[model samples]
Target: MENKNKYIILTTMLIQSTLLIVINCTIIDTSTLEALKSSMPIFNIMILITTVLMLLSLKKANSFIKKETELELVKSNMKNTEDLLNLLRTQRHDYLSHIQAIESLIILKEQEELEEYIKGISKEYRITNEMIRLGNSVLTAIINTKKEIAEKKGIVFHVRCKNKVSLHGINSWELSSIISNLIENAIEEASSIENEKWIKITISYVYNNFVFEIENTRKINNEIGDNIFKPGVSSKNAAGRGYGLFIVKNVVEKYNGSIEFKTTEKNSIIFKVILPSEDGAYGEKAI
Candidate 1:
């Protein structure tokens, strides 16, 4: 669009310049024609060259926009597939655990213990269901799904949300992308620590702000490079693995929200996000 506008401006300027030159040639005496002749062809040639340049620029701009949009769609699909795979993996692991528990109970002949074990699992699932049952269905699904993954990884995950969050302008998929990337990074970083690794996530409305925080354990002296969030800046040596935090930053900034990271020498790393709570603003709604 910008390139097209520039082309239009250049075309107008060319017309105006040509008209001015013609008027001067007609109004002035014959002597001025020789003076104008030297510069007029050069000016016309420049106008033609600029027109061609504008066309090329517009074509390149259009191609770039199309490619970017396609890449975004691909990323969105990949995130969905990853989320589904995580869910499936959690269920598979749980099924194996259930079978093992039943087998152990059968060998020990502990009917009461087996029943109690099943009941305990059921209760925990119920609690998980309730924590993410927000007013918005999409957020509810995202939180609950991520909660299951966190539990499967033995990562202590916590949530505190209210029903007043407005999700008007934010797309469900983008929100999923943002939260999923944040939580996944937290889990991965926490898992690297030797201590009791945990991730605490809180979403709440305070005054006019909607606040979200995810904190997890990490090594004290781990120096995250200044360019850690840049695209392609990955701890992984392999390709295509380092874009998570870069996308997270982009999504957060898209909604006029801000995210900060803090680390203590011997403590934990915390990521805090604060966004406006106005209608149509991006935030997680309480179930």
Candidate 2:
């Protein structure tokens, strides 16, 4: 919408300026008006070229604004993540004590209680260490933070990346925005349903493109299915619930990437983004 508004304003100003120029020309003395006629074609051509260049400049400005906004968001997320980790570390200071207690319980022949306690700790560890060591720190940070958000909302978040998935030429922040937005939307949609809610993310390399598949157990309304990526389209029935996918679509397209999804009436939605791995494969190298 920000870019759209700029385009509209630029276009309006262009039309107004063109009209004013023509009016000024009409009011000139007849001899001068006649002299200007021969140059009218050239003047109009120049105006057209200027208009095109101005629009291009505006579009480039919009892209830079978006990049800066996403960068700030990433920095904010990283800071909050640092705070969250510190808090977790503080809480986990008792981790060793908890293990000692379990050992003491075992020494006291309390098999049943020790078993339950160990199982609980194991589950917690699973949630905290959900993703494999995929050698991509940016993606790891995104999944960790998003997983915490999902768990707090009673949503099950799972990641499957057994093999290495490197974003060959994409900026870490760019990939971070893409992954964060997709999973964030999935969490929102899946949490709305009354039935079982879960989100699964799988990352793999299909040769030239790195693919991200986020599957969730929520049925999207057909009304929204057609325009899901269009800005302001949301099934959540609330304002500010629709920008994630729109941003995802824009970034994916900027890289000459493709974003596709499959939704079913059976309460399942899968979004797949395939981005080229080679630098300059699709877009002007992101600044």
Candidate 3:
């Protein structure tokens, strides 16, 4: 449809310009004919350039609109899905078991054991709440699940957000996708190391953008760090695998967002994404 419109506009311009020149030569006068003969080519050239630019602009607009539509559909599907609910249900069931164990510890009068259990549970609860602290329930579930996976694999996970973020007008699925893939990548990279493995996640709304950042403890090579967002590039040596950052970049661009890569002071790499929030930033809405 876009191409057809461009073609029609271009063709109409060419035909109209041609007939104008013909009309000038046949009916206007000799002076007008001479003027048309010299200026005609420039006119056509200008018209062609204008048409081409218009077509390019229209193409870009179409792509952006399509991406927005896809983002909306993804958000809708995500809202209707049961995966997050099921995940939380499982976590809740596990928490019940923890509660039972704590009760038994209390009844048995294991003072030292109960104290240690209380401390451990407090730390775990803090980490879990940090995941959803941003008030975006969808993003929270994703971060929570990933944190759980990281802990299960002996990877330390950290979330540095205290206030709930208002991630208004962002697609939940793509947002979840971005958060999940980055955290998973961080976990995978940190898991490859032997000691001091940790992944730190930060969510903030600053400078008119909702920021999502992931910094891990694994060292990154300059080569991988430089071309990290490119498709088919991965530090993990496996064929047909490196689409994580590629998809991440795709989603960020769809939302008119920006992503930055930096090598942290600890020689590890960090990915910082700044996405536009339609309602801008908000205050104190805990999830």
Candidate 4:
């Protein structure tokens, strides 16, 4: 919208200037301009050339803006890819220890302990498997990565999916920015307290809309609530602390989607995002 308004203002100014120049020429003394007829035509040609150049510049500016957006997506995808690789590497490294532990358990003939250890190990991968089942690599990477971060901070991160979701009009990077930012904020807020900390993420496709509901245990105060969506307004007092929701709000609006949240009776915050989907077969349900 800002860009559209800028183009409108620039075009209007160009048209106004051209009209004023033409009006001045029309009201000029005809005899006085007789000797400068050739120069007058050249001047008009210059104005036409200038107008064309201005329009072409505007077109280039628009093209540049588009390229910039694409570049940002590419950068985001690269970062997500890097994170996924790091996660894989960490898992691989842990597998060695897991194998060693299993071997030791087997050597000691501790069948019951071995079974429990294996169950616990398998439980750790359950969320990762579910994330992969989401059918979107970007979503899986962001969620799995953030889940690890949350768990490290002693936050119980849980995720639920009603079914496989289809992100019809949105790309991977856009999904990353939206989901990652929300989850990151949740992790930040949930990890701040000394009590029971938890984050719950729910995803579903309902009535042609892909829905994401992220609930985190936190009490929103008046100061944060008033300007939560504004840039630079963060609950944290650190430098460069805010702007997550601002970006999420912009990306959600870009795809004609809506994002909103409500505080639960238990003082938990649940952020819900609904984006239009290509397949419209699902029924509506509560998050």
Q: Who wins the TM-score comparison?
A: 4
Regions of candidate 2 where Cα sits further than 4 Å from its true position: 1-67, 76-91, 99-120, 129-131, 279-287
How does candidate 4 fare on TM-score?
Answer: 0.75
lDDT of 2 by residue, 1-287 (tens): 45565666576577658766775765574467577677678667767777776777677778878778877767855764574576468558868988899989989999999999989887876644444355567776677777778888899887887445556677666787788788888888888888798999987666677788999998778888999999999887887778878978988998889999998676799999988777323222211
Top-down TM-score ranking:
4, 2, 3, 1
> Backbone collision count in every prediction?
3, 0, 1, 0
Please tell me which model should have the higher TM-score, number 2 or number 3. Answer: 2
Candidate ranking (lDDT, best to worst): 4, 2, 3, 1
What lDDT score goes with residue 211 in model 4? 92
TM-score preference between candidates 3 and 4, better one: 4
In angstroms, give how far residue 56 of model 2 lies from its true place. Answer: 11
Candidate 4 regions with alpha-carbon error over 4 angstroms: 1-33, 93-132, 238-241, 281-287
TM-score comparison, 1 vs 4, better candidate: 4
User: lDDT of each prediction vs. the true structure?
Assistant: 0.69, 0.76, 0.75, 0.80
TM-score list, all predictions: 0.61, 0.68, 0.63, 0.75
**Quick one: RMSD of model 4?**
6.5
Better candidate number, 1 or 4, judged by lDDT: 4
Candidate 2 displacement at residue 257 in angstroms: 1.0
